[model samples]
Target chain A: MIKKILILSIVLSTFMVAKTPKEIYEKNCVECHATLPSSLEKMFMSYIKTYSGERDTKIAIKTFLKKPDLDTSVMSEVFLDKFGVKKPTKLNDKELDSAIEYYFNQYKIKGRLN
Target chain B: MLVSRSKDINLFRQSEKVSLIRFLVLYTILVASLLLLISIFYYQSQEKLMYAQYTKLLNTYANSQIKKLKNLHHYFPQQTRYPRSTKFKSAIYDSEESRIFSLLEKEPQYFDNKIYRTDGKIHLVHTLDTYYLGAKYLIIEVDEDRTWLENTLKYILILGAIAFVILSIFGVFFVKLFLKPMRDAILLLDDFIKDTTHELNTPISAILNNIEMIDTSQMSEKNKKRLTRIDIASKSVSLLYQDLTYFALGHKMQKKDEEIDIKALILNRMEYFFAIGNSKNIEFILNLEEVYLFIDKAKITRVIDNLVSNAIKYNKRNGTITIDLTPMGFSVKDSGIGIPKDKIESMFDRYSRFNNTEGGFGIGLHLVKSIVVEYGFAIKVQSSLDVGTQIYVDFRSKGYTL
Candidate 1:
């Protein structure tokens, strides 16, 4: 039992290391979205078109992630029916906010034109 | 003659000054209002030209932005950034006029006009033929350069000043041109009078001397009466001749100041006018105090003579003339055809006549006023029409003595 307790402590300590926002987003959001037909950049474009600003777009995405529902989904009804509604995220407010921020920076329509 | 000519020229200068001022005021108002109207139109057109130039440049920027937006839409997965430029800032709006994104210093408050200026920056809104990244309206903003406006205003001010100066010079020339005929007519009248007065002096003196040599004591009553009329007529002509001579040439004469008893002078002038007064049945009433004055004797005598002559000439038949002399001054009040109230102010003006019925030139009062002014004496006239007139010469200034 003492050996089992020491092994548990070692695993928890390894999990305790803080991840960057980009890493956090990739580990949580990209992993599941990789199976979806629409790309993550395409979803971000729909949010940007509908929400139209950095703050509103991030809030809308964060809200949808925290409580996944058909009514709150930015995806079309056909797309949702094919892929099924996403389950509610287990991430807390701070982690969800950081992930949304990283997602917005990666795909936002700024500074890319030649 | 030279002195009188100079005096006439001085009078001409005074009238010219008055007319010049009047012309300058009207001319300045006309030119200034015209300049202001021109400036307003110039500024508005300049502003329109500036806006047109800037709108053309901004439209180019907007087209480039549209091109960039199209490229981003074609490579949506690869393009990670939006386009920006240091030359200008921009924003986009959807078909419903909601802002998509803005990098502008100030948010646009209106979208109706294609181009407008606000907060010192120019904004141009361009509509895209296709929705480039859901942007139906692309708004380009740039700093509004004001160097053109500054240069325009500077040119307007400099040109306006030059125009005003040139117009003012023309105004002076116009005034001189307008006054030429009037000055020539006045000088002609002056020369005519001088020549006429110069010719009359000898004949008037000769007539007076011949009339004084006549003796009517031994003649019949009818002859004596006729001779007395001739003497009186000759004396009147002589007095008129003296006044004309003085009016034309008095300024050139040297002043001979002396202390004279004014009482004796008034009494002597009354005796001289006795025949003329008798012809009109006018009575003389004297209230003389022994007053003396230090002045040019000929000038003072002319003053007294003109006052007494005018009194007799305007007096009604059986009317009375009252002569009052004191230390302060003297007044000659006549029960005559008194001057009208409106005509009283101009009574002392040369050749101004209110009564054409009186047989004399109208230079009597003007000559009196000239001498009075030269001696720094104040003269006043009080009159009521159809009743009487009183002319007072106050001598308490430079001419008065004990």
Candidate 2:
């Protein structure tokens, strides 16, 4: 029991120190989104098409993640019917901000156009 | 004859210079406005052609972007990076006119027009049929190449200068052409006057000499009055002839300056006009102070004769003629048909006649003015209609000795 508690404490400390925005996004968002019909980039493009700019797109995505709502989702009703609304995210504000920033940077269309 | 014609032309040129300048100004403005209009049209056409070429090229760029986006959507669905190029900057807008992505230096404010320029950069907006990457409007921007504009402006400047030079040459030719008839008429009138003056000289001298020889001492009062009238008429003709001769040839005459007693000169001129003044029952009141001046004798005589003659000619019957001769200047005040205030300013202009009832040419005061101006003297006139006229010649500038 003492060895198990020491090992658990070490793992918790390691997670606290080692979790970057990219790691957090990949662990929390990608784990579930990877199984969806649309890729994470496709959903981001949907957000971009609806919300347009970086700040609005990020706020929109964060709002939907914080409180899963069908009215605010950029996805179509057909897609929503196939795979119901997503669950609200459990990340705190600071963590959520960093994760959203990482997600925006990952799929943003700026600088990639030839 | 050729010399006289050339002299007449020179005189005419001097008098008509103001007219020529007016014509040149009007002509230059007309031609400049025409050139400006042509330049504007040329610039607009050139800009339109350049824009058409740019629109075609930018449309192709937009088509290429659409193709790339389509390929990305179909084959590279998981591709994390968007396509890009270094040739130009671009932006994509969704169906709702919201920007999906942009690499442009400036965001476009208007989308109604397909292409436009702003901040020295050209932007071309092309609509896409397919919503590749959800982009409904593609805006392509590039730095506007201004070499064509610079070249067009240079061409316009060079052409405009050449056209102006050509037009000025034509304008001068047209002005001369337009004035040719007037010049010919003036020359003809001048020759007629010269001939008339030459013919009248001998007869006038003969009449004056013959009249002086006639014995009026033994004649009847009526005969004596007739003789005096003939004498007065002949002298009037003689004075007119002298004025015409001077007008025709005064510029070519040599100056003979001498010191003369102005008081004596006035007295002598007054004697000459005494009979004419007497015929009108005009009284002469002389207020002469001894004054002397060094000037051309003939020119000064003309000035004095004109002033005295005008006083007599314009004076009312039984009117007073006041002659004032001072060290500085002289004045001739007459109770005559006074000049209107508006006419006084132009009274010294050649052939400017105010009283048509007066029997004399209008050259008297104009000749007086010419001689006064030549001697750097000033003339002042004060007259009121139906009251009287007074003319003063200020000779202080000529430094008259007392």
Candidate 3:
């Protein structure tokens, strides 16, 4: 009976997982950044768009986000002035990269915007 | 003063007393020296023991205080207060005076089995030497605690003094006790001399009288020879009697320091000994200087009598006796059996004799030695066995010019 219940749970959880990049971002992110402010979000969207067009989009976005220098930072001076410093995203390097990938594919001009 | 007077009695004044005293003196010196050394060592050791005990007491006090402070530290590591006990007063320090602690409510004193100045309360502080956790952080002061040592020393000194007094008493007692036998011996000897001299007095006179009364005209040649032998025997006894008297009383002879004609005295004594000298067929050769000396007459006569008679007695048959008297000294030389070298030193000891054949009781040289020493004179003997003996009496040549 325990084996049959475990098999049922594994199969049900696989269907709930995001199958594409858009779904990955929708499922994992959106809570902190979506409501933060438009200016900050727009800056973050630009960095995603710029790095997402590259052939090695995962590597480029992952390195940039993990240790963001002032030159590579996506946040504007206005937003930084309002909030004196941005808290570091707690997601690991690979997780943040994957999330960024999912966000880029969902919002890309070519992809579905919803 | 009375001791000095008694000490002044010479052995010559009474020879028996002198010998007894000499023996006692030697014994006392030896015993006193031994006791004095032993007593000093004993007293010093006692004094040292007292000091050692005093030091031990101080150490005990320090150890007890240290132990208490360690306990206090265990209970109250940061407590700056310490309880004051009647038994001790203490001071504590911690970390170079970063913290100083005391446990005395007031000064502490232990006197006459009572504690004083205790403040009737406890004092508290916290100080410690963290560098050495075992250091004495507390020192307890006991007023006049050192009195234990001082009293010990005082009692030791008193004991030493008592011991010294006791030993001194013993020394005196033993000295007198040890001399008792010698004293008794002297008294017995004196009684014997008194009785024997009295007994000899009668016989000597009787022999002389009988010799003189014998009619030699009617007797034969054999009878004359017998009479001469009796005469010689009488003279020998007379000489013996004179010597015994000299030995017994001669030391007390006064130093009259009279102007003495040395040459005349020698001739007179030589004449007295001529008969004995002739009996031994001994010839005399005299070379006398007209010298005078300042000395006791009786002592010089005794010295002369001993030397001349000994020469005659020990002379060879028809041997020569030479008497040479000068301003410097006089020598009596005899051609007879010479003294053995080993016996020469003891020759002057009373009754020390080398010749068993000689009729002397051996007091002759001993008497000569005593008289010579009394007058600050020196006598040297030179001898070879079966050859001869020479006695040189070196008078104070410079002092005896008179």
Best by TM-score: 2
TM-score of the first chain alone, every candidate: 0.88, 0.91, 0.53
Inter-residue clash pairs, candidate 2:
A112-B82, A112-B83, A113-B83, A113-B84, A114-B83, A114-B84, A114-B85
For residue A60, give model 3's deviation from the true position in Å: 59
Q: For model 3, what is the alpha-carbon lDDT of residue B212?
A: 83
lDDT of 2 by residue, B1-402 (tens): 111323353545556788778888999999899999999999999899889999998888888877877787554445635668787888888656777778889888778788988888899988776556657678999999998899999999999899989998999899899888878877787778777677777788899999999988899999998999999999888788778778887876788788988888888877789988899999999999998898888899999999988988888999999999888788999998898889998999998998798766788899999999998899999997777899999998766553
Candidate 2 Cα outliers beyond 4 Å, as residue runs: A1-114, B1-14, B72-80, B94-97, B217-220, B384-387
Q: What is the C-alpha lDDT profile of model 2 across A1-114, one tens digit per residue? A: 999999999999976785899989999999999899898988887776566556767888889999999899888899999998998899998889999999988876765544
Span of 10 residues, lowest total lDDT, candidate 3 chain B = B1-10
Better of 1 and 3 by TM-score: 1
Judged by whole-model lDDT over C-alpha atoms, candidate 3 comes out at 0.64
**Model 2, position B128: C-alpha lDDT score:** 74
Deviation (Å) of A9 in candidate 3: 39
lDDT of 3 at A103: 59
Which stretches of model 3 miss by more than 4 angstroms? A1-114, B1-144, B209-215, B252-261
RMSD of each: 10.2, 7.9, 23.7
* lDDT for A53 (candidate 3): 32
lDDT of each: 0.83, 0.84, 0.64
